[model samples]
Target: MRKIWTDGLALLGIALVLGGCATSKEDLLPHDHRTMLDIWNVETSGSAGGGPAARQLLDARQALRRPLTEADVQAAPSVQARYTRTAANEIHRQFHRLPNPDLLMYVFPHLAGSDPVPVPGYTTLFPLYQRVQYALPGERLEDY
Candidate 1:
């Protein structure tokens, strides 16, 4: 009887939770279709850029902002060109790969497959090291 009561209470609790979750998002949210910008303007209506702090921020920004002259615009290209990547600058080649010797392998001709067909011999080259190694910048990549 006690187990039956506990099971009934658990079912009631689950039904209550499901009922709470069944409310549509449209019912929960404001039905008035006000835009985000409209809401922002309404919220900040009385204090829009009129506060002392806002005035000080605007003044500081005005002081920092400078109009670019024709000379400044012309000089911009030279400054950018100095830092631009070129073949002579060698900016991309920061790390040098360490040399790994290739090992030559020759496969002898043999009969292969269920029908026993003659396979031609071939030569192949493989790197001695399993993985390629790279030297850090300023490290001696050349053999001494």
Candidate 2:
């Protein structure tokens, strides 16, 4: 019984030492004093204008301020067209849809019940275009 008790105590001591090592060393150190908001405020307050990130942001803003040349304006449409997407392209993407056209018809009065009853004339509507039509780039909204 004494031997069993000694062995148990030895096992417990080993477990305690291993458990201490299992904890991260970084966890033993003090936590950060500043919150996320504090960090963001410091970065955006312009007080750090000498920092590399601030200089880069200033350079980008200056580059954007440069006037666009005539050639650049002419090329803008092609660039916009390449990047732009039509309504039809968006609808047809990721889903399958059949082209169903709308039709308009007038139904004449008829009598075709078990006891021949008169039916009144009525008008019905359906889609004329089979597929969805998308507006062209730079097309006027008023035209649509």
Candidate 3:
């Protein structure tokens, strides 16, 4: 009984620690440049020199948010060019993005259940469990 009590306390502490790390919906919501850049490493590659232009746009975005009044909108001309190229590239990319054949089965884990959600329908969703949290019963926080 004493051993079980000790184990329970340990598991409770761990769950609290891990749950604190859960990603909130707020984190995934789009924000300004600083936040967007945190996840996406945007590059303007192959469009009037994408690398430098993209960086300049990033810098310009920072500058725009500051008190500085002298920032010319065209200060990052290369970035504009890159943006145009990127826009075109994006349209092209849409053609390349196709639905996977395996997705049909993946979506409908159980064929008998009231018709499963479409595969692509849930593509944008995230994983429910992390590898670190894959513990059984008393060994995990959920158990506690």
On lDDT, the leading prediction is 1
Candidate 3 — worst ten consecutive residues by lDDT sum?
Answer: 96-105
lDDT of 1 by residue, 1-144 (tens): 999999999999999999999999888884788777765555443335445555666678788897998999999998776566778767577667989999999999989999999999999999999998998656897786
The segments of candidate 2 whose C-alpha lies over 4 angstroms from its true place after superposition are: 1-29, 48-50, 64-67, 80-144
Write candidate 3's Cα lDDT for 1-144 as tens digits.
999999999999999989877967678774555544433444633334457767887788888787634455656675455446465566642222222223222343333447764433223343433322333222323222
Q: What is the C-alpha lDDT profile of model 2 across 21-96, one tens digit per residue?
A: 9998678986688777766656654544446766677788899999999999999997876546777566544332
Query: Could you tell me every candidate's TM-score relative to the true structure?
Result: 0.35, 0.31, 0.18
Q: In model 3, what is the error at residue 69, expressed in angstroms?
A: 44
Residue pairs in clash, model 3: 44-50
Candidate number with the higher TM-score (1 or 2): 1
Number of backbone collisions per candidate, in order?
Answer: 0, 5, 1
TM-score of 1: 0.35
Ten contiguous residues with the weakest lDDT in model 1: 41-50
Q: How far is candidate 2 from the true structure (C-alpha RMSD, Å)?
A: 16.2
